[model samples]
Target chain A: MDMRRLVGGNFARLRQAKGLTQEDVEARSGFSQQYISGLERGQRNPTIITLYELAQALGVSHVELITPQNDET
Target chain B: MDMRRLVGGNFARLRQAKGLTQEDVEARSGFSQQYISGLERGQRNPTIITLYELAQALGVSHVELITPQNDET
Candidate 1:
């Protein structure tokens, strides 16, 4: 299981759960919607700080972004 | 609570629990001992891949490094 995909999937799931669009995350985290799209597509190599900011935007722990889900991929 | 310190503490605690030194992590993760030392001091802002690799070296889940422990910091 690739970590990028794992993170991407988690991000998408969390964002959807909160009823947030990419633009919502963009406004909250100051990361562009384009970047958010790239991240959700598993195309970004984010630093820990990026992970931290995203977690902040989503109102969850940073660890949640990187944790593997119950569904095996 | 600083995430860097949290990660550093977790890394240090886990490594010590396993009786492994920075040298041992270097051998397993191909990261320099000096870098490991810096990371242990919370001086390094590691990337996601770095976190993943270090977890591999430590034989723990990557989330463990970033997760806050029971101790108050």
Candidate 2:
């Protein structure tokens, strides 16, 4: 299912939906902007704790970061 | 929310609920039994890909590994 791409797309979707930039997530999550950028591009595999922190910073549940939307359906 | 503890507990609970041992998860997940034990014990921070693999090996959604159960309610 290409979970990496799914997660990246979902993360990007959610962040944009919230009107946030990667820098905002970096500031709130204590992760570097490059790291966040990598995650969104599916170029990095983040730890569960990182995902949790990013979710918190994005004002969303961690589950939302991995669940794909209906676009595939 | 002590997210580390929460995720570990959730992972352990879900694995136990499925009646699978750490060894069983290791065999199915291709992750080391020691690593699985550490994760269950809240001593290891697993990557998202690792979480996904664990969930797949456990026959559950990745979200299940991070969601807190109702016992906390």
Candidate 3:
């Protein structure tokens, strides 16, 4: 239920799944690579606007970033 | 690509879809109603942990919250 930790974990997983680097997201989303890194590390608190941009950059819905996968059936 | 605007829009849509009031999410997610309102209004910059918690309370994956629905498609 920790948003930061969950987002960081999910972000890392999704980014890796898509074979994307932080730099790529930064370039696509116009967010700084350092900011993305901070987000992945749970060190940054992003506004909703930032999250939407990140989702767009990732080619996914904004919900995908906040939603938890049903890994446990 | 504005994260806050996207999140706020999506949040409001989802909440309306489920007939959920901000208080309902607040009770379920342990986040304050005011906070949820602010988030929906794109007024709050939540940490990843907070986002994750909100997702749980909403009974969806974290990704769902961050991901944008393909309404056009």
| Highest lDDT against the true fold, candidate | 1
Candidate 1 is graded, for docking, as: medium
Instruction: Give the Cα lDDT of each candidate.
Output: 0.86, 0.79, 0.72
Interface RMSD of 1: 1.2
Residue B61 of model 3, lDDT score: 59
Q: Candidate 1: where are CA atoms >4 Å away? A: none
lDDT of 3 at A73: 23
Best by DockQ: 1
Give me the runs in candidate 2 sitting further than 4 Å from their true place: A27-29
TM-score on B-chain, cand. 2: 0.82
lDDT of 3 by residue, A1-73 (tens): 5566556667878898999999988877788899888888977666565666677788876666666566622
> How well does candidate 1 match the true structure in TM-score terms?
0.93
TM-score of each: 0.93, 0.83, 0.57
lDDT of 3 by residue, B1-73 (tens): 5566556677778788889999888877778899888888888676565666677777765556666567622
Q: Encode model 2's per-residue lDDT on A18-72: one tens digit a residue.
A: 9988988787777788887887788878777777777888888887887767883
TM-score of model 3 (CA atoms): 0.57
How should the candidates be ordered by lDDT, best one leading?
Answer: 1, 2, 3
Model 2 CAPRI quality:
medium
